[model samples]
Target: MFVDTSKEVRDPNVSAIAALDEPTRRRLYDHVVRRPSPVSRDEAAAALGLARQTAAFHLDRLADESLLDVVFERRSGRSGPGAGRPAKLYRRSTKQVAVNLPDRRYELAGRLLAQAVEESDATGAPVREVLHRKAQELGTHLGEQNKTEVFDLLERYGFEPRCEGDAIVLANCPFHALAREHTETVCGMNLHLLRGVLNGLDEAGLEARLAPSPGRCCVRLQPAA
Candidate 1:
């Protein structure tokens, strides 16, 4: 799973012994995602109406794959006469492991483009020309900010940045679908704008790179055009 932190997590490692197939994976994903808490096997079973054993199997699988982190309530220094083991707690990892982001993507993009249209009309600039100019400006702006605070800035923009020394890794974006679907159209335009923005910020030669796969999302952008 960590093989490529630069790419979004795709088909996260699920335990084979736990009997987690794609369908089970989806159910388990929904269960954890809706609550964002560590649920016991019994709790997940009840939530999904599956057998306790079945739930346990899947929960273990998720943990093995690193999708879920298990938390154990440590046994007191002094154990009771009959106390066996500490209760195990389960919770979602802090990672932004979401499955989709079409709505938010379109929402942000629409606003940006709409504003561009209004500004173009106000200045009597050709729509395409104005957009191209704006794209450059935005790209330059982003580049400058990323120069010193790439991680912090990306987080603000909803892009998960996992820093490894000098390599700034983008784990995911809230606009994966929008970016892919409109890459050459709306998304491409946005990417160009980001390029311009980053260039201005001195982050030249950056590129947007996304891993092509299911259950993963991200757009790695270079600062330079």
Candidate 2:
């Protein structure tokens, strides 16, 4: 069954996206980004037929959310005492924001795979071996960084962990599509990753192993016997 993991954390990307829900703010953002260069409140106000105050408010809000970057420059190209204060201008920020329901981390998987291939070519080790090692290292680092209970830690990474007797079943796989197409390789990486997590966390009561089911993640955490 699907689990709602949104309540577990407040993602900044979601907040940034929510900031655009306001009609006027969204309009101001669109106008500013479409410009060839930084746009001043006056220019944005005139172009969008909005009041200067309205444009300024929305532009500032966008800047607050990192949706737009703020800059100050003298429009007259003057740099003397008589030039007056620099005008505030807005531009699209370099920050990228993305939010996906059920949470996917294809970038992490891609990076792990790429590192494996590169390291294998350099050391002549098998690609799969390198991949499993790297994945485990990363998982260990994640576990070390987040010193929480295993279930909470799993949930934080988008694994919808649920109890089934003494075992924890994952309702979702963050690398769903990749796992479907390349089961052995991806699932093997996942298994080793979780194993590292347990090792890093010093949790000896549970062990991560491949127990592939029809609709869930291939790896399951069962009570260590």
Candidate 3:
């Protein structure tokens, strides 16, 4: 499964997957994806042996969830001022979706590890050092992409932040399993990552620090002292 960073992304992905759960809709979707070009409602309906209205409803639902892209074009060979109304067409969206329980981000970790290995081999640097640096860079990049408040950003990444007195405490560790097995390495990397986030966002109110607690994240972003 792919890591979706926010409810906005994950909810629609869930809806799209759910929509495909219906047998007819699944068949129609399968057919549409197999085609090289965008398909019209009529084509989808006929191909799937479904009524036009049924096909339209399911197609529109898929489009709503962004599983399908909607396009309009004059399918018929026409020209000039007398060209007819454009036909509405459906095509598989380029968007990729992955939803995971407990919010695992193995793919992100894998990418960082892979890049670290490649760079270390090329430049003869230590793999662990390169990996940590790359992970920090990725965290900074993620923070730079945040268009919302820090709270929203934390929530989006599944940090499960909650206010505790003057500081914010994270209730969940997004990298639970990795941290459990490799405590020092993972926790240090996580700390640097969040520190990079704060740096990238120019957030001066809080500082990411290591303050391991049970049933919660090992790192906390506390009010700067």
Candidate 4:
């Protein structure tokens, strides 16, 4: 059966995080990333006082999760067809991983804020207006990319979406800290983002509304009048 690569791409962070759960793996990971050059399994084992086999196992696991990158080289400074198979070297992957428990996406907010500032500087538009517009555009684009149910799309983006009768209750704010620190600004941005999502989805039966609740997201999608 054909597999979904988009889902696969989004999943490595979870695997990478889980790979670090083992004490030995964590130590090896720390050690490898600290080195300026790639590390061999033997070198990692000796540095961390682990058996070569143990080090190799964890290293391979890290590579499997894309936490580490693998390369081959002749460690003896010799090159020839007769020189035998090159040693496998491991290095820190260029990939970045961020797994927020409540699924906060501060980075997205930061980017939008930065862009708004730059555009405001260039065109003398109000930064707040630029930010809200950009956020709405992004939300609309996100919704347009999906043919799945709106709730599924929200869940995929870590909204922790659930239903309360006819309304959709988002249980987690993906911008939790920002929302707390700058409630008015962030909540307004979020409200517009959800509105854009609804518009892009052409969801005539639902409407995005700001209805702050304790222990849940400040925005709710309710049935249209």
On residues 121-146, what C-alpha lDDT tens digit does candidate 3 reach at each position? 99999988988798788777877776
lDDT of each: 0.59, 0.91, 0.83, 0.88
TM-score of each: 0.38, 0.91, 0.73, 0.85
TM-score of 1: 0.38
Evaluated with TM-score, which candidate comes out highest? 2
lDDT of 2 by residue, 1-225 (tens): 122455665677999999999999999999988999999999999999999999999999999999999999999988999999999999999999998788788888999999999999999999999999999998888878777789988887888899999999999998999999999999999999999899878889999999999889999999998
Model 4 residue runs over 4 Å out of place are 1-11, 78-84
Q: How many backbone collisions does model 4 have?
A: 0
| Order of models, best lDDT first | 2, 4, 3, 1
Best by lDDT: 2
Supply candidate 1's per-residue lDDT for 220: 53
Better of 1 and 2 by lDDT: 2
Candidate 2 residue pairs that clash = none
Per residue, candidate 1 scores C-alpha lDDT tens digits across 102-203 of: 224456566667767998889988666666666667656666645554445565455666654544556664566666676544545555565564556555
How big is the positional error of residue 148 in model 2, measured in Å on the Cα after superposition? Answer: 0.7
Tens digit of per-residue lDDT, candidate 4, span 148-207: 577877887778888999999999999998899999889988988888888778888999
Off by over 4 Å in 2: 1-8
TM-score of 4: 0.85
